[model samples]
Every structure is written in C-alpha cells, then in structure tokens.
Target chain A: MTAQALHQHQPHRPEDGHKLHGYPPGDLAIWVFILAELGAFFVLFTVYAFTRLKHLQLFAEMQRTLDSDAGMINTLLLITGSWCVARAVAAIKRNHCRASAHWLLAAIGSGVGFLIVKYFEYGAKFAAGINLDTNLFYTFYIALTAFHAMHVVLGMAILLLVWKKAMAGGYSAQDHHGMETGASYWHMVDLVWIILFPLVYVMR
Target chain B: MGVHFLNVIWVALMVATVLTWLIGKTGELSTAMVVAVLVISAVKGWLIIYDFMALRRVRLLWRGLVLGWLLLTLSIILLAYWLGIK
Candidate 1:
C-alpha cells in the first residue's frame, strides 16, 4: 500500500498469479482438483486397507512372495526426480532458462526411469505366476500400483510440456505457472509412490 | 552437504529395508517390527513429501492437506490390520 503504487500493471488474465485480487483462479482450480484427488485416493486406500486387513495372513503371504528390492529402487529414482524438479523451479525463478530446461528434462527422464522400473517389477510379478485374480491381496496390490503407474505416465507428459514451454519462452522469471503445475503434479506422483512403497511392498 | 545428505537418505532407506526383513524373519519381532515399520514409513513419507513434494516452504494449509490424507490413511490401515487379525 505504497502511496506511489497506484500505477502498477495488473494482469487481467486469471492463469497468471496476479488477478483482479487474491490468488489466481487456476491455482484455486489446481488446489480443488488436488483436494478431490486426495479424497478419491483416500476412499480407495481405506477400502484397500480394510480388505487387506480382513485377509491379513493372505496379504502377508502375498507380500512375502514379492520382491522388495525393485520397489525400493523405484522409490529412490522418483525421489531423485523430485530433487531435480525442485532445482528446475529454482533455476527458472533465477532466469536461467537453459538450466531450467535441463532440470525439467532430467525430471522427465527420471520419471521415465521410474516407470521402466515399475514395468520390470510388474513383469516379474506376472512372470512369477502372480496376478490380481490370484488372491484378495494381489487384487489391491495390482489395482493401487497400476493406478499409480498411470499417474506417473500423466506426470511425465506434463513435465515434457513444461520443458517445451520453458524453451519457447512461454514462461518468464515472474510467471512460470507451467513449472509450478508440473512440479505440483510430479510431487503428487511421488507422494502416491511413497504410500505405495510401504503399504504395498514393505508393510505386508 | 546437500548431495551427501540425500545420499544419506538413500542409505538410510536401504538399511531400513534390511532391518524390516530382519524383523520379519525374527518372528518374535513381528509385532514390534510392524509398529516400527509403520512409524519409520511415516517418517520416510514425510521426507518425501516435505523434501520432495516442496511442501515444506508452502503455506500451512497445504501441509495440512497432505497431513490430513496421511492421518486418514494411517487410521484406516490400523483398523484394517486389527480386523484382519480378529
């Protein structure tokens, strides 16, 4: 509220952080979508936990049969990707477009690596004569992980677009919604994987 | 110390995995191990969300949203475990 601040150039569009007043509508949308998503996943997880608990011995047996190593490695990869994305955001804010591009690419690449690892893990499960229909526990394992895998795919796509937009100068130091959106989605992927790793892989 | 730090987490995670297996194998350690696993996993989950999700810097409401899900998830998991044994 400076006396000389009456001539500020306000952004009319709502996509950018500056609106007529308060936060951008897009940010609100993203938060609403995120909240809704958490609710959906919460419901799914509650049901999964209930069923797994109802069949604890079977779930434990199922977990005992699966390999935990692969899951651990995937966890490491996604976390590294998260670090890269964070650096990307920092670089973008610092006006280092090229460096930001590299970080976004690395984030996308690591996301791909995560999925590749997931494929191998799933492939091994299938190869070793295990599947969703085999038992109640496998049903939850497959369903949850498969849903997470799909999110990973979606996140990578968003990251790729972020990379492209950054290169085209679609974002400046002051306005980088694409980067923010990408990181938020990527973190969602990482969060889901965190739950998946312990619940589906380790806890049992 | 940054790279070294994340590397340490990587190591800690590996060790936790081995420790989980050891506890699982000990049989006598299963119940305690299960509780330990849940607690350790909760810590590790926060590491990922705060360090990785970039939630540490955001508004408190954002952190609250993530934690809300975690608490719900934990309570349900406990209920499920209890039901399975009963």
Candidate 2:
C-alpha cells in the first residue's frame, strides 16, 4: 500500500483518451456509466409520478406517513458528503495527499450519518407494520428508496477504496482520475436523492 | 475549482432544497407550484453538474449531453404532472 506500489499498480493506458478532449474530471467511461444510471432512475421516477397521478389520494396519504424530517436530514447529510468529496478532489489536485484523505474521511463520515438516519426511518416504518406490499405508494416508496440506499452503499464502498489509495498517496495533482471517478459516483447518489426527497416526501 | 466556489455551490443547493420543501408545504397541487418545484430541482441539478462534477471545464458536447438529459427528463415529468393534475 505504499505510494510507489499503488502508483505502479495502475498501469499507464495512453489509449484511454480521457482528458484529451475537454471533458469532465473523471474517466470518460464513468461519465457514461453515470448517464446510464441516471437514465434508469429517471424511468423509475416517471413511473412513480404517473402512477401516483392515478391514485392521488392513496399517494398523498402514504406520503404523509413518511417522515419528511428524516428525509430532510438525510438530504443535508448527502449534500455535505458531496461537498467534502469536491474538496477532496481539490486538495489532491494541489498535491496535498494527506489533506485529501482527511476530506475523504469526512465525506465517508457523512455517508455513515445518512445510512444511520435511513436505518431509523426504515425501522420506524417496519415497526408500524408497513411493508412494500402495503400498497402502491408504499411499494414505490420502499422500492425507490431501497434501490437508492443500495447506490449509496456502493458509492461509500467506492469512496472507501479511493480514500485508502489516497492515504497511500496514489493520487496527485496530475493523476487522480480514480478519485474523480469515485467522487462523480457519490455526487450521482446525492443528485438522485435530491430529486427523490421532494417527489416522495414533500410533494402532494 | 476553488474551494470557495464549490462551497458556494453547496450552499446554493442547500437553499434550493429548503425552498423546494417550503413550496411543497404550501397546501396545494397547482400546476404553477409543481412547475416551480421542478424548475428548482433542475437548477440544483445543473449546479452540481457544473461545479461539483466539474462539467464547466468540459467540452460543450459532453456538458450539453448531461444538461440535456436533466432538462429532458424534468420536462417530461412536468408535462405528465400537468396533464394529470387537471
């Protein structure tokens, strides 16, 4: 896990052509992946909205049962985490590896807070005998949020790996594509939740 | 991007989220309010794309593709809601 070892592990790929064309910070492949992921969520959200349109009363009632307070808190946590990720990228770009790692750790901490809040939120619902099969709204609610929770877990795993490499000094100002990739994915998770929070928890 | 710049974007996003919540609490499902919420969400999404994702430095094609997706999806959803609202 030494810096040299980590650096040597990533073989150079000159043909990658990532930043050659004025593109975003991350690997081009990842941007494509993010687009596909967002596309999937877009379909799911559309389905939820149109379905709710048909059963407006049921949707509104089930929405009231949700804890908007918890949703709002989770929204804050994810946004803060995303900000930390941005800072981490900025720090590494300045060749401040240790600072980058610190910022990433903070970002991971925010992710942990989000998961804990979500746990309690889901726990409360289950305790009240609510399940996906409870009704249409509950079904979409659990499905969309649970799917999103899985994405958050995946994003956290990516961040953890990035943090470990960062601590080993794997990333520097010129070569932090891995960190950028992980940060991009984390932001995608946050983005989805931003839209999801209002549509599911707040909108009537 | 500067740390200060990213922080500003983050703050803007937080403010947008609070406004979205407050507007949703206005106790009505009028088309105007729904469109407003959707517009705010689009703005928040763009801020993240441009700043946090560093899309601003990217070429116009890549930037346009992502931004196009956001607007297209939001427009479709807004249209659906508008149609179903009445």
Candidate 3:
C-alpha cells in the first residue's frame, strides 16, 4: 500500500468502540494479558525481596560477585529500545509506515545489544562456578534475570513481526493496533528490568 | 514534535539510570540511598508507562490500574528492604 492508500484509510472511526468506550491503546485483550504478566513478575519480585531480607549478608556478598557494568549497559539498551518502539508507534500514528519500520529496526538493534550484554554477563557468572544452585541470591538472580532475558527475546520477535508488517504498509495513522500491542509488550519487558536491575544488582 | 518529546523522555531516563548507577557505586547500603534508588525506579517505570506506553491518553480507570500496580509493587519492595535493614 502506498501513502495514498494509507491516507485514504479511516483517520478516525468512532464506531470502532475505542473512543466510545474510552479504551486504552492497543487491543483491550492485550492490556489484560500485559497485566497478568506483570502480576506474575510482581509475585516473583516479592518473593525475591522477602527471601533476600532473610539472608541479607549472603545476598549482599553474592550480588557483588555479579557484573554491574553489564547490567548497566543492558539497562541502557532496553530503555533506548523502548524509546524506539514508542517512536515507531508515533510514526505509524502519523501514517509514516517506512519511518515506523526504520524505528522498529532501531529498536530491534537495541534488543540485540541487550541480549549480547546479558550473554556475557551470564557467561562470566557461569564461568565463575556460579550456577543457579550456588546460593539463595544466585538462585533468584539467575531465575529473575534469565526469565526477563527470555521475555526480551519474545519482545524482539514481536517487534520483528511488527516491523515486517509496517514495512508492508500494514499499519496506518488510524489502524495500528498491532504496533501498539507489540510496543506495549516491549515496554513491559523494559519495566521489569527497571525494577530488577536495582532490586537485584544495585540495592545491595 | 512528538518524536522530540519522546527523545527528551529517553534522555531523562538515561540520565536517571546513570545517576542511580553512580549512587550504587558508592557502595552505601544506607537506607536513604536505597529509598532514592527505589524512587528513581518508580519514576522511570511511570515515564515508560505514561508516555512510551501512551497510557496518558487512556481513561482514568486504565491509568489507575497500571499506576496502582506499580505503587503497590514498589511499596512492598521498599517495605521488605526497610525491614531487612533493621
């Protein structure tokens, strides 16, 4: 579809039930799913906190053995990636499909960077004989960060799909639910890391 | 114009991250510093949700749902941390 086709697209459709219901962005179904995911993480984080409190000294020592620099870099990557996704959504909202695709690609690059930093960080820990069974701190550390890393991979895949569709002019200023859905999911991943980084790595 | 706004937010988030990292590097387990870090995390989370996720444009109910969850999660974590410090 060309710019002309997108421009001809419905700029505003009140009957779509979105504005009628004063709905949130993206699919309402996605918002429900996103909340469920966040709820799971919330439970994990709460468990981590109380458990760490039980063994503060051990947690503190184990945390020090991890790589803060890598964690910091990964944090930066995810934040930038989230920003890029936001830009991608913004672009498509204005009927700029190609620009949106470009922004999605930039976001994907950030996702790749995050995974690379995470790979080396995990590798270093494993090489140090620090396995998941190492201790309490190591256990939650591996579990939380590893779970989040997997989400990053999933987010990347979703972003790739969004990118391919955007490149094909599948979204427009009026109908870009797919992009918002993917972007919302990606931002959740970023949000998880935001809390994880400080809670696990910095709050020692 | 919107892109510029998002860029400004990105910069703010980066600066906040760096500041938190520097504070962590101080190696201080002081309650004050921990509180500061948690506060920063909340702010970062809010920015991503409100702007990046575009929750600001949504209805009050949805905003409340997300932000309420955030507040609850952060408060619990902080409470646990404070207890651990004691």
Best by TM-score: 3
> What is candidate 3's DockQ?
0.61
The list of candidate 2 runs beyond 4 A from truth reads A1-21
Tens digit per residue, CA lDDT, model 1, A1-204: 443332232211213332223322114445556667777777888887877755767877778876677777787777778777767766766678889889889988888888888888889889988887988888888888888888888889888988999888776667776677677777777766666676767765
- lDDT of each residue in B1-86, candidate 1, tens digit only: 14445456546655665565455444332445657866766776676556555455455677777877876676677667655555
True contacts kept of 3: 0.70
Interface RMSD of candidate 1, in Å, is: 6.1
State the lDDT of candidate 2 residue by residue for A56-153, as single tens digits. 88988788888888888898899899999999988988889999999999999999999999999999999999998999999999999999999999
The window of 10 residues in a row where model 1 chain A has the poorest summed lDDT is A17-26
User: What ranges in model 1 sit over 4 Å off?
Assistant: A1-26, B1-29, B82-86
lDDT of 1: 0.69
Off by over 4 Å in 3: A1-21
iRMSD, all candidates: 6.1, 3.4, 2.8
State how far residue A183 of model 1 sits from its true place (Å). Answer: 0.5
Measured against the true two-chain complex, the DockQ scores of the candidates, in the order shown, are 0.32, 0.54, 0.61
Candidate lDDT values, in order: 0.69, 0.84, 0.86
